[model samples]
Target: MKIGIEAQRIFRANKHGMDFVVLETIRELQKIDQKNEYYIFVSPGEDKCLEESKNFHIIEINCPTYPLWEQIAFPRIVSKVKLDLLHCTSNTAPLYCKVPLILTLHDIIFLEPKQNDNKSWYQNMGRFYRRIIVPRILPHCKKIITVSYFERNRIQQTLQLPEEQIIAIYNGYSKHFKKIKEPREITSKYIQAKEYLFFLGNTDPKKNTPRTLKAYSLYLKYSDKKLPLLIADLKEDIINDILRKQKIEEIKPYLFYPGYIPNKDLPYLYNGAFAFLYTSLRESFGIPMLEAMACGTPVITSNTSAMPEIAGEGGILITPTSEEEIANIILELEKNSNFYQQQVAYGLQRVQNFSWKNTAQSLLNLYRQTVTS
Candidate 1:
């Protein structure tokens, strides 16, 4: 069978959750399946991360815009390929796709209320695009894949889709995420601190950066140990604005905002960190927590969303809205050595259940089932 997978943004330099999901899953599929012909479609990008194997083809489509790439150029190319199935690894897919469509809707956060009025032109445009495209394309989808059961339920209830139409498949972190022997060599490029709390924050409101900063402030105010906070992917100016609004400017000196930490250096950052803060207000799946856990770092994540389910019996869970709850957990982890060690162990064990191989195998099985049935 011929399969066409839309891995449009995976080749981009700064990859996010969905990009890695497509990249890792395809890599695993290449390892496991050699019989079927696989066509991996992507826009022209500088990072040519994925290579073409005998059965697997990396087709780079040159288009100026995402809409044009997917809407205009994509269909023209795939229409000629005569694919048995087409899997779009992102939330939006071509409305006029001819073959059986499989869409990985990571989350319906854009469809949810009180969303971040993101100032980013690219992000807001993407959200608007999803809002317009998702409802139209969902009905045509043969199978809809989501990152977690929580998100699956949301898609069902909110979108009014049948349960069988949507299925939950967990995402996995990279194997490179495990504990580093010595992280300082790589981490020194970002910060000189021997130990610090690592938070991956952005201007996105769901990341709950303002409240997390407030919680860190409380930790510094109350606790004797005032370990500095190192935040990644967030600009210095934006962070200062958030801190200023939260009235936690006192914590500025303790902040290490190098901004936009390279994805390659993430494991090193996790290895050198005292703890990983992943207290997002909502997440379909919290892969960063697993990444931190896999790195032998204790993750302080929110009790909400799929985090508790994914956290699997370990790591610190706090009420995302409560800064005091977040602050107390941070302090406790620092004060109690035994508890911290136990968390590290729990993280390592929890990660065993998730892997890119598992995700790819599930997808491969789904592909066969859909094409046969």
Candidate 2:
């Protein structure tokens, strides 16, 4: 089978959840499947991470914007390639696809009620675009893949999709995100603090940054250690604004905002962190939670959405709005060595269940089944 994959943003220097999912899956597919020919469709980028192989090819399509790129260039390219199947890795696909289309709708968050306004114009626009495009394209897709069963039910009920047409395939963390020995070597490059709390923050309202900060402030008032917080992907100005709004200006001194941290250096940060905070208001599947767990770090995430299912026995699930619970858990992990070690063991064991190889194998099966049917 000749398969075409729309991985538009994988080549970009800065990648997020969906990009990494496709990138890691493609890399694994390259290793596992030698029988099928594969073509990865992407925009030209500085990263140049994916390479051409005997049966695999990289096709770069240049466009000024995402809409023009997907809605315009993608259809033309798919026609030229005459692909047996085209898997749109991102949420939205070309409205007019020629062949069997399988879409990996990571989540249907766009269809849900809007909460706080987004900080970035691009994010707000992206949300708007998905709200318009996703509904129109779903009927055209032969199969729909979502990241978690929680999202699968939402997609099926919210969109009124047929049960067989959509299925849940869990996302996997990279093998590189493992326990690091002598992690101080890399952690020191980002922050001077030897021990700290790690939280991956962004402008998206669902990230629940303000509440996390509020909880951290409460932790500071009680905890004797007073460990500093290391936040990535958030600017100082934004952090200051959130701190001001939450009325916790004291945490400003305790925070080290590095703006953005590259994926390569994340393992060290996770390894050195006293504990990882992922108390988000919502998530389809929390990849960072698994990444932290793989590093043998205990994760504290919200009980809602797909978090609890993904975290399993490993995570300390607390209500995102409960500052007292989050703060107390942080203090408990620090003061009690036995509990911390037990959580660490559970995390390591739970992490063993997920891998990119498994994700790729399932995806490859879906491609073949769709094409053959």
Candidate 3:
């Protein structure tokens, strides 16, 4: 079988959930299967992360914008390759493609009602693009893939698609994420404190940054020992704006903004941190929660969406909206060493259920099935 994978943003310097998922799966597939030939379609990027294997081929497509790239240039390239089946790793796919299509619709967040809040132009544009493309491409796709069961149900109900058509394949964290010995060397370079709470945040509204900052402020007010927050991928200006809007300027003293931390150094950060906080409002799959667990770091995430399903009994679950609850969890974890250790143990055990090898095998099966059918 000749398989084509649309990993448009995989080569980009800053990779997110979907990009990493596709890349890791491809790498795993390379190791396991040499029977089928694979082609990875990507835009030009600085990071040449994936090496070309005997069965895998990397094709670079250049376009001015994402829409033109995916909608126009991508299909043209795939048509020439004569792929038996094409897997669109990202949520949106080309409206018109020659080969049988399998789409990994990570989340249908855009299909939900729009929030009347300030959002970046890039965020709004991407949402708008997905809104237009997803419906058009769904009927054309042979199978639909999602990251979590919660999202699978949501996509089925929202899109009114048959249950069997959409399959939930859980995402896996990289093996590189584990308890790092002598983590101070990594932490000392990024942050001032020897110990601090870690949170990965960005401009995305779903990240729930404003609420997290409010919760951290409450934690500082009540706890006897005030631990500084080490935030990654968040700009100082954005943090200040959120703090100002939430009227939690006092959190500035206990805040450490490291801007953006690379994926390679994340395990050390997780190992050195007192705890990892990921109380996002909604997520299809909380990859960070799994990464934290894999590193043997205690996590505090929201009970909503797929977070509970991912965290299970592994980490502390709290309501995303309740700043009080989030704050209390921090204090509780700090005060009780037994609970923290237990959470870490549970997480380490739970993480064993997921791996890139499993994900790759499932996808490989899907590709063969799609081609044969």
Best by lDDT: 2
C-alpha TM-score for every candidate: 0.98, 0.99, 0.98
Provide the overall lDDT of each model, using Cα atoms, as 2-decimal numbers.
Answer: 0.91, 0.92, 0.90
Segments in model 2 whose C-alpha atoms lie over 4 Å from true places: none
> What is the C-alpha lDDT profile of model 1 across 341-368, one tens digit per residue?
9998998998899999999999999999
Kindly report the root-mean-square deviation of model 1 from the true structure over all alpha carbons: 1.0
Q: What is the lDDT, from 0 to 100, of the residue 5 in candidate 2?
A: 90
Give per-residue CA lDDT, model 2, range 1-373, as digits (tens): 9999989999999988889999999999999999999999999999988888899999999999999999999899899999888999999999887788999999988778876878699988998999999999999999999989999998999989899999888889999999889899989987888899999999999988988999999999999999999999999889989999999997788999887788999999999999999989999999999899999999999999999999995569999988889999999999999999999999999988899999999998888889888
Total clashes, candidate 1? 0
The runs of at least 3 residues in candidate 1 whose Cα sits more than 4 Å from the true structure, single-residue gaps closed, are: none
TM-score, candidate 2, is 0.99
Error of 1 at 302 (Å): 0.6
Worst 10 residues of 2 by lDDT: 110-119
